[model samples]
Target: MPAVRLSDVAQDAGVSLATASRVLNGSTRVPGKAVAEKVEASALKLGYVPNAQAQALARSRSGLIGLVVHDIVDPYFATIAREVQQQVFASQSQVLFTQTDREIDTEIRALRSLIAQQVDALVLVGSHRYGNDSDAALTALLEGFARNGGRVVGMGQSLGVGRTIVPDNAAAAHELATALIVGGHRRFAVVQGIAGIPSAGDRTGGFIAALTEAGIEPELSIEVGLTRDGGHVLAQQIQEHLAAAPDDPVGESLPLCVFAPADVMALGALGELRRLGIDVPGQVAVAGFGGVPDADDANPTLTTIALPLHEMARQAVDWVLEQPDEGSAIGPEGSEGGAAHEAADTSPEGSAEETPSEVHVRGDVLLRESTALAASD
Candidate 1:
């Protein structure tokens, strides 16, 4: 069978080829209601699919959104990706998704591919910075994309590029730590996420700040991947700490509060601990960030800073799809911002403006059984 073309639709609709193109190809020049209805009906009957490139050319819009995430398998990013995909589809657009696996080169490659595809906008989730030369190529690609009038939405404050939605990671962690302290948790350990990723740093940094304020220092600050594998490594460290004081059974009287900045990592650590026959909140209490659904389902429910992952991802979609009248070029210089994406002021002192290029979101702390301080028998 031959592919159905514009000519076929036009012939079936008893309209000109140009009229069928205008009606089905998303040309800005819409035909009259009756003509459009006729063209659409004929195309539907004929099973004709409009060429995406042709539609893009007709409307000066691609109807495509590029979403680049660190790891789609990570529930945090998975939730965001799911929300973004749904929202974009609702807007009659499609999402072009790519995963970076937390590697800079992979992310750079993904960005290059998306740019080449000429996606109308982009939503970048959970890419963190190492604050060095590794950032150069990534920065260049983002800058060039924005310069070329492509809209970009940043899910976290990685390099502060693009119109950003920042979660109050530090404050949320601070509050969670303070809550644990009030609950009589003394000995503490923080399993940090990938070094240099802003989300990991902010969350772990926030937790440490609370300890510092209480004149309490953590017994351990271990750095690891923000993934489950990182949690496996964390469980080993916990075992070492327990061995140092095996006399107390590592519970109640000497329980350790192990905090992982991301829920995936925390869940990872929890699973490993259970595998090692170490009881949670009995021997060790655990908490994590992002509040992924799996946290609630863990053997011992996990504690976490429950961020509005779905809503935040929605905001990223809304920003990218809505797009400013003239998108502000993304960089340290900031863009011409008369349109606002509202949130807390994390920007510098003199950088205040009537409408901001960035938005801030806060998370809620949930203390679950995973972090309960149960007394020993």
Candidate 2:
């Protein structure tokens, strides 16, 4: 189908090309009021739509926000992305989404593409792989974006590049650990995600730290992909491990608890457990992170950490739309602050310049049937 161009509207309204452009593009130099009304009516009648890119270039604002995530299929990322889309839409702006599959280089390419497209701001949602050359390269790229007047916001890992909404992964995992400990199960196993992702490390590390602090060493630690298939594979591994001591009941003769740290993985693990004729809580209690909407839909429900995904995404957009105060950039500290910004103060040295800020969001622990207290015999 052919698009309705400005010329089409002009001809239909018996107006000049320049007049049609002015009326449709919000140009200050519009024709007479009567002519403008006629052109608008023509556009409406013909369903003419202005070119957003051309309009953005003329106004020096694209009205487009860029969003990058790991996997859109994952509920964690989906929830946040939906909120971002809603918030951006509310502001008369739109979102450009990209998925990197947890690859740093792929993420970098996505950001670069968004930058080339002249997006107003960049919002990154997913894990951060820090302490590497890629991290330095990413920092350089973000710094360049900032220099070009583009804003950057992070969700899980800050990368120390922009305003970051960090979730207290470790603290939440610690709470989960505490809950499991109080439930009277000691021997433990972990089905962890890809090795270098900081968010993954933070969750597993926090749980392990808490167990160590309690003088309990975990029995098994299995590394796998950050997918449901990974969880299923981990389930197979568990079945093999338990088969060696078939006579001993899990959480009793062997006394075991499993932590997957991600709801999808835990749910997959649950399916595998049922396939192997294992009873949850009765055989091995399980816990996960990310209180996805369907957590309660699992056969026994899931015990996990519920993150404020909508709030975080909404704030990401809000921060992007917010005007930086004179001198300092916006931080996530005060009423107008968040994380850190560029050292170059936009305001005078003596004046109150807003610094860049970091907004750390905490997760709530939901204890459900999967990780419920063991039944006393």
Candidate 3:
């Protein structure tokens, strides 16, 4: 038997093809209940199955979503990726997952690949290198995708052409830093991640902002990489700085604290502090962001800020699957509309409105053995 088509269903139901199409597509605007019933009955009797590809061609939607991330190895990203997969699956759509390892070239390549695959939408998580310099390239590519009827959303920090979901990095950092300060730690060391990443900047800013508000001059240090090893290096630098002036009142007697931008980095800082015979919380307090599960299991449970990575991912995927505004061109490219294009084009004034789907889940400060009041006091 030949495959049943919309035309056949419409003919059998004594309705126009357009009405039959609307009914089969589950549109609720059909004029009457009886008409909708007739169309549905005709479709069932004819064993009609909508050709998804053909439907996509007609609707300009592939029903495929793309999820692009910076690094999968990082537990934070891993947790987010898992949530994204679950959310996308529930929407009756498939996902194309890719990782860029924080490399611009890799990110560009991943974007191109997703575009070629005709994904209906995109979700970018923790992409580091997007800004005005690459705006033209990103805009052109996203516009083309939109013109082809694709949507895009962004996750994490960075001005991009989509909705964003991110942790309240700045606020969380400020809160965590304040916790250390209230604990009587007057002298502080900060371990910041890669310089250009927005998350890193936000975290560092938060730490500095807190110190500034407390009337304490911030001693800032930045690391080029975002990893445990980078934290370890900063740890060594802190030790060296202390050694150079062991007899100084601030260096010898002031409570010392280290604020690592991420939990993994905090773990590394802990390792270095231990190697140098520094007692956690007893001699120096350590704090970090992104409360991964392993943080609790660490020798000294990490005192850190908990970012709801999974929830953020789930929300991001949900936003990406949402319907685009009617009559909105995909982005000057004549493709379907995308959040990425709008984000890219958003001006400083409009940025607050067009900022990608960021769901700022409040972060809690988790106090553990790793941080405490100064032992001497």
Candidate 4:
């Protein structure tokens, strides 16, 4: 038997080859319901399989996008990837997800692989710092993609080329830190994510800014990684720090509060605190960012700033699908003013000028049993 082609399917359906192509491509602008049904029925009867590469060549689009992420196990990135997949599906495009494991070399390799595959666009979920020596290499890679008329969007932050879709980390962190301050917390401990990552820096800066606004000197503690284990280790270190402090003559317990940059870390902190017989929100308060679903179901519901992962994913796809403009060169910078720019550019037209599109869909600070007023001396 000969392999069935688009012409064969169209002839069998009594329609033009273009009609058969449009139907298989999932175009919504096809003529009418009857024509669409006929094309679909013919396709089914012939058991036709469209050659993706040939279709791409004809349309001048690969119909595929690359999604590069830091870690697949992390709930935050996992949820965002899921939403991205759905959005790509709606656009009649496929997604190729690649994890870099926070390594620059891995990220570069992933980008190169995506380019070789001829993806229509590149979506970088989370990437680490590129070295000075490797800067040219990275730039050339992105420039080549752009020069070829491909789109690239960042889910976290990118140095150059394309747009970024991210939450209001600084504002969200400020809000959560202010909550601790309002609760009368003075002595603070923080567990940071990867040292140089933009998201980590934004979160840490927000925490410091909140403490500075209150005229309280913040005690800084940084963990190497951003995982749950990182938070657990930091929690133990905080306990050790407290133990080393000289006992006050008045028996006054120091106001202790732990600010984890991510909810996974916060959960780890809670676990360590409980293991040490320390009551959460009783002896100390714990707060984190990126409200993972499991946080709400924890032994004590976590107090977290909910990042709009799904909405961010959806907006990222939209940005990639839209035509790039001169303003597309602007990438996310870890500063209050930079955040403002990102928000303005990504937002829908005629909406609040100050309201950033990335931050628009953010979830509220959910207060649960995990936090409470600081204990008195």
lDDT of each: 0.79, 0.77, 0.70, 0.70
Better of 1 and 4 by TM-score: 1
lDDT of 4 by residue, 1-377 (tens): 99988899999999988788877764444658899899889888999988886566555567788888888877888888988999899888899889988777777898888877878778787644544466577766765565455665676655466555656778878888887767656777776556547787788888889889988776657665687787778777867876786352224464467788878778888898889877787665788788788788876888889877777777677666653222222332211110011121253222221112232334467766677664455
Candidate 4 wrong stretches, greater than 4 Å: 1-3, 14-38, 127-132, 246-255, 323-364, 374-377
lDDT of 3 by residue, 28-72 (tens): 455488998999899999999877665554444566788887777
**Model 1 stretches astray by more than 4 angstroms:** 247-252, 323-356, 375-377
lDDT of 1 by residue, 117-191 (tens): 778676788845656687887776665565555667788874445677888889999999999999878878987
TM-score of 3: 0.73
**What are the models' TM-scores?**
0.87, 0.82, 0.73, 0.79
For residue 116, model 4's alpha carbon misses the true position, in angstroms, by: 1.3
Return the clash pairs for model 4, or none: 343-356
Which sections of candidate 2 miss by over 4 Å?
1-23, 26-42, 246-255, 324-356
**What ranges in model 3 sit over 4 Å off?**
1-60, 127-132, 158-160, 219-222, 251-255, 275-277, 323-361, 374-377
Model 2 steric clash total: 20
Query: In model 4, how large is the Cα lDDT of residue 23?
Result: 75
Q: Which ten-residue region of model 3 has the weakest summed lDDT?
A: 327-336
What's the residue-level lDDT of 88 in candidate 2?
93
Tell me how many clashing residue pairs each candidate has: 0, 20, 18, 1
Q: Which candidate number maximizes TM-score?
A: 1
